[model samples]
Target: MRHAIGLKIGPVAFRVGSDWAGPIAALADLYRDYPPPTGVPDYTVRLEAARPWRRWIRPSVTVRGDHMLPDALPLDLAHGVLAAEIGMNLQLALGERRWLLLHASSVERDGRALIMSGESGSGKSTLAAVLATRGWRLMGDEFALIDLATGAARAFPRATSLKNGAIDEMLRHVPDARFGAALTGTPKGRLRHLRPDAQAIARMDAPAIPALILFPQFGRPEAAEAMGPAETFVRLTQASTNYVPLGRAGYDALTRLVTAVPTVAVDYPDTDTAVGMVEQLWAALP
Candidate 1:
């Protein structure tokens, strides 16, 4: 099949078309030991081998998709690689713009960014949906790119993946919310997309200043609390998997982040209280 590569990810431009040869040529760029120029790829590889060695990829090499196969595949198997590919590229692309990718959920309000970061099943996605339904702009439900130099946050617009009763709970509160394309039976369970704000969706590549860095822990009801910027920064940096990968560049970036942004921790039970609590925290930001 012939395909056109439209996305520029890191140093590689993904050129896939209707032709099977499209992926073949794109993968060829992955063979090189040095990072190629803008259009030329550094190396390429087969689809099956993607997950294990993805971390070894360097700007020095361009990875092409040489799997020469149809897009049709089992939903569960396909989602993992797809997520890995998308996540890797998202991290690289935003890094070029000086953003540090944080494994967190982020939403926006009145032009400022509020981040909900935590381990899996920590209720970050649920909180994001609540904020979205309550009139806050949904930046992303999974990954948040924080500009280390400026303490600004950018959107990584994608479907919010909710699981179990979380979906029903969201529907109860936000009957009008739009769910994106369904991707089911994955490792993370059946996943679906939450409709993103059209305007926020359009500005996915744009960055907004960080107003609040929140570490959300959803459970028994409690008053919303604030965490010191220093503590918040420590936790955020610790929670990150790539912060150390960036080394000195990473440290400089993270320091700038806590110094300029107000980092906090929030805990609550239901969506109503969580939304109100987040609002109070944001209201105090400049």
Candidate 2:
């Protein structure tokens, strides 16, 4: 841990340390606009060589922090940026308790938030990134933080992780300066990190009411369906990382969210169609 950087994204603060300066430098550049934590960081992520000898020969980064998966595999030095990102996510997923965390992507418009959650291949991240560029505020792409007391969605707008074709699509719309280098050979295939716009970073502290909950699936025939409250509750419980641990507080927060927000399931073959469908849905919101 020779080099380190502290960053505050929304309400969470993280201190990322690395044995090598490369990862730390990359993070500093990417999160340059973000502010430092007010005081002590909420979490600390360490990137170190798996073994002391490995530091000099064929170095690899082992993600270590307050919460870690013992069996988690190390990443090559080239992918250290991604390793750092994953490390921060690990700490939040395992340790955060102040907010009800949802494994989803979120965007906001006119004080209303849209929450999109689905399986691995779902287009939530890509969709959120696209919407952010089209006048919507990017709340977050990895984890959507929900205030347990007010039922509002707070911004956690970290870099948007774009995978496979989504990266190229985003490149077509966004400028080069907004993207990280294309990361190849990732476990999830070709990936790139898209930095949220300055507007998103500037308004990171603003919270929006949860107005829509969407379960989106890409590469499917275009269709939209209303979801029942029972099914939505079950699926959301699965989507949440610390739902059971939070017990009644988590349950009540989630219950209020599902009850208050409109839920929909969308299937689309392409991004344009999906965008159109989402626009139509938004227009019809009561």
Candidate 3:
């Protein structure tokens, strides 16, 4: 708990403390553009050594804080930045109750939002990043927050985690983007972090009305199918980490979202084609 930093990303604030300086420094560099969080943070994440000797010899970092997994494994110090990121995700996923959390990515155009939800390898993150470059505001990465009081899509544009090939793809398009070092041998494999565009950071607090929802799947022939409310509701509930915890408020909010917004499932063979499909879909929205 020696080296630490506070971050304000949209509706959430995080205070991450580390036993070593490297992780904190790395995180600070990645989130340099963000404003320092004021007042008490919504969640606290701690990076600690397994034992006293571990800090000095063969250093390792264990994620701990307000909410923790009982059997979470330790991560090598070399991947401390990832550890910190994972720690923040843990706290947010487990502790957040203010907004209805969806494991999705989002972008905005013309003051309305486009949310893409899918499982790992679905290309949602890459799609969001690509869309951000093609004239869409990056509203969020990894999670999409829906305000319970108002059925609006709040921006939570944290640094986007680009894995393996994604790192190269993003680098090519976002030439001036600031990126964290590629950390190899992690569970998800050679992942790097990309800071959100300046526009995303500057408008972190802005909220957009949800206009479209797309479930994108990668490695398939291009196709699009509309998802009925029943299926969309189930899929969204599965994606949300805090749906059940929010109870009736969560139910009402999600129902409003599903009924008011149309949902689609799209398949694409690559990023370029995916972008085209998304734009076409966006244009078709009524």
lDDT of 2 at 84: 94
Off by over 4 Å in 3: none
lDDT of 2 by residue, 66-143 (tens): 999989999989888999999999998999999999999999999999999998779999999888878999999989
Instruction: Give each model's clash number.
Output: 26, 0, 0
Alpha-carbon TM-score of each model against the true structure: 0.69, 0.98, 0.98
Give the Cα RMSD of candidate 1.
9.0
The better-scoring model by lDDT among 1 and 2 is 2
The residue-level lDDT of candidate 2 at 137 comes to 95
* lDDT of model number 2: 0.91
lDDT of each: 0.59, 0.91, 0.92
lDDT of 1 at 250: 71
Q: Which stretches of candidate 1 lie over 4 Å from their true place?
A: 1-97, 173-177, 181-184
